[model samples]
Target: MTSAQISPRTTAEPTSLTTRSLAPDLARGAMLLLIALANIPWYLWGAEQRDLSQHPVDGSTLDRAVQTVMLIAVDARSYPMFAALFGYGIWQLYSRQAAAGTPHREARALLRRRHWWMVAFGGVHALLLWAGDIVGAYGLVGLVLVALFIDRADRTLRTWAIVLTSVLLAAGVLALISAALLAAAGADLGASGQVGVDTGVAEPSYLASVLDRVVTWAVGAPAQAFLTGTIPTAVLVGILAARHRLLEEPERHLPLLRRTAVVGIAVGWLGGAVTAAQHLDLWGIPAALDWGFLFLQTSTGLLGGLGYVALFGLLAARLRRRERGPGRVAWALQAVGKRSLTSYLAQSVLMAPLLAAWGFGLGAELSSATAALVAVGVWLLTVGLACWLESAGRRGPAERALRRLAYRR
Candidate 1:
């Protein structure tokens, strides 16, 4: 089929980072803050009693509060939002190419080339910085989607999304129930323990870190990120949503947006809050609450992600009517979102030195609240930098390079 027949005749270029949709960009900027908040302090847990992947059980009330807030609003909540946006961006790239008159085969080739490079960037990010690298997983998922579903019909996308969502929820519920039963029967199988100890996410030698990152990328990219179905299902929703320009034209779909935002946020918040409270055992410290685990993750991933997207879409519509609502901060956040990839990597670059043992090792000393504050500071620094870049009419370093490689221009 010819390029013209393949895509809507939208005048705006999806790849034009300089002037993309404010809603998506704004959401991306906000999501990065949450990502930094959720991930930065994750490495700060003490190695003595608490697990590497969990908050220190012995935190003060303030630290506990910080931990609880992150669990309810940040943690697994950010990833699916990111995944959905990634999917939307993928469609944007493909449609942009088609609109620009590239043949179908050529556009697909370009996407493949771009994604493989993303995988390399992800690998480099993992090896040099954090072991919890997600870019590799995203790149892997993007490639598979391109191969399997990019050209599918809307009905097909919806069907697959629903099927995957069902499967994921079923698996999580089964796993949660099994773990609860095990815990009741006096098995410590689900006890939170040191996870990233061997990984570079914990204190490790350079060589050990490299090995650990490689192993983590190998396992997490192929297995945990995509196979769990959260990412894939979110991606499918993004694709179908893109076809209708749901986020782009939110006013046209206010009813859908409002209902989704309400239902999604409520469900997500309830599940996440319960999970946090159970873990904290605010009443009293008891045995592990295995039942809360799966519900927290799955609900936030599916429901929280949708809520975030819809909420931002509604906000964006209202802001447009107001003509730059909360002007300076909104503009700054949009700028940061425009350079999201660079901003995302910048979080690790700034925080690793302060937080990881491989560097200055502040993570060993900082309280949870302090770490979260530092993360916010780091995100702000990037926002300021992004605004400066925006004024200069320059793409962020990573975005510039990625575009060049993707388009060979």
Candidate 2:
């Protein structure tokens, strides 16, 4: 172990677009849509909030339908997928450094710096636009996980992942059983008014709203990353997947991808459907059991998120078989994925003004269906921006900035 071996002459450079894998990018590009859908609902400030629900209590049939579908497919599912991908990206970065002859300690320090910058980015994002920002949460988790587990053996990663997942499952089960028992005992556990934080989206004052958003972000980021158990668990599994180059070489793991896609999506959707039923009052579920349903949905969300990742991996494999390569739509989506951070922040940029009460306050005037249309439009706009950047051979501004900060000697 010579000093030269311990410290490479130069650190690894950022990955070039040409060398980037298709599956991860494609998955990211597509999931931004889901993230849009999930976040936009919080902007509907004029609508009546329900206990244990992100959706408003009132809407048209179409709005209800949209809400149902979103609950079943989007809500808790998208972030975990992003978390998995984030973890995978971390591993990719760390490995690239190792391959470039950087020592483990130095490489870890580089990643720590990057993650800290991400936290800063998220804080600014939350303060300026959306309070429900995920960047900080993922960054926070990345910092801890990289320091603790980045050098751990494969078996250790797997063991910890399993332990975390089991804990989530057990928590879900206990919540359900306790709720049922309380309901049977005739405990008055009905709707206890609206749940969730007031993130100043509905506030008429911009300065006041800024305070609200920052406060919400400060509390929610840590709670989401650590307390929920979903993000951390998914992140661990993502590290394991990256270790095997699952996304990078999807063709080599067809059977596993296919099985995970099928089973994971099925279970995730089933859990979400049950929660949706309760939300819609279609199942006549006791209000006492609201937390139970919520727990079930969150617990199963990790699988749903991973299922989406596997599905995209398979899609990437199919694209590889094409003679002309991916079509225009695939290329466009990949562009957005390549510039994902910019595209993601761009959603807040586009929507906050039009929808927030401090701005034009369109959220007060929109229903679920309309809000969804707005989200999709915002996403499409980002797609176009990403495509333009791709054509110009320029990285997204956010990406370029982060790279400069992270790679600074």
Candidate 3:
């Protein structure tokens, strides 16, 4: 093969761990930490009232304080960042496949195989370890979008991204407005929908926790697919960003990045704060009725998430100009990012036994701040392990298996 033909293929294949960017990997690594923090609450089932929510309504002052902080910045913020990264990563997959001169039909078939496996993995993860599994939804929506838009033009990609995102956001804005009208009319909306386990278990039992997970997973899977449009919209944005060379070449798009960071973050923080206030009873709203707040985040989170992407891109540009490559921290994060699938699953493995009622039974005992500290410890464990694996020149077990499945023999 000519050098020209070989060069692109050599760099495009991410499965080989070549041609990776620091910022994307860093973003993924940071994203995992945040996801850990967000997801830990799902495991908390106490020996008390056995009620589950994002946080205990009757938590100590510190727990309430932690809940407010999380609601404003960390809770809804992390999902979109993770979703955007997932979308961006898939684009890398498709592009590399094309660059390798694989035929359209074959490439698509391979994509299908990878995602279906992902679906299987996600299904297992949700049922066994955690019910808030997003991997399955990403894979499901990914399969649909890849088939629909892989061959579409940049113009069409942008249009669809805008439209889908707009639809999701509009729904949120409408809901918020309606809720305001209801409040004005003194209508009692009442507590609706399950925020957490909500199993009504008075004391923790292994069997009860298992039952909770099964029921929640069964319910969450369908809600994840249809409720928010979070997956497909993020995927579309990733496609558009990839086509425009947004994250890959950030310095050239300074104005765009600046605008996105400022506007998206401002809107996101505002909406999130409103939700947090209401949830904390600062706004005198029932904490159980978080659907309104969920809508607020759902509407604005895409912007916040994309803004984070842009902000990270700008940071990457600075890092590139300053040094030859990343430092020790970046290297550690990249290691986890590179093996994101495995690192993510490892958290569940580590935490399920530590936090679950079926294991250490720490869930009922710890407060919000303490639980978050535990979450950080869990993430740090993975980061340390990822660094060791990187030093040993090893791929994550899940990543290796996934490549074998996706690439076939």
Off by over 4 Å in 3: 1-14, 47-53, 190-212, 286-289
RMSD of 2: 2.3
Quick one: RMSD of model 1? Answer: 3.9
lDDT of 1 by residue, 163-234 (tens): 887776677666556655665676545555444434465654656768877877777777646666788778
- Models sorted by lDDT, best on top: 2, 1, 3
lDDT of each: 0.76, 0.89, 0.74
- What is the lDDT for 254 in model 2? 98
lDDT, candidate 1, at 91? 86
- Per-prediction TM-score to the true structure, in the order listed: 0.90, 0.96, 0.90
Of models 2 and 3, which has the larger TM-score? Answer: 2
Q: Count the backbone clashes (under 3 Å) in each candidate.
A: 0, 0, 0
**How many residue pairs clash in model 3?**
0
C-alpha lDDT (0 to 100) for residue 393 of candidate 1: 85
Each prediction's Cα RMSD? 3.9, 2.3, 4.4
RMSD of 3: 4.4
Model 1: CA > 4 A from native: 1-14, 45-53, 181-192, 282-292, 324-326
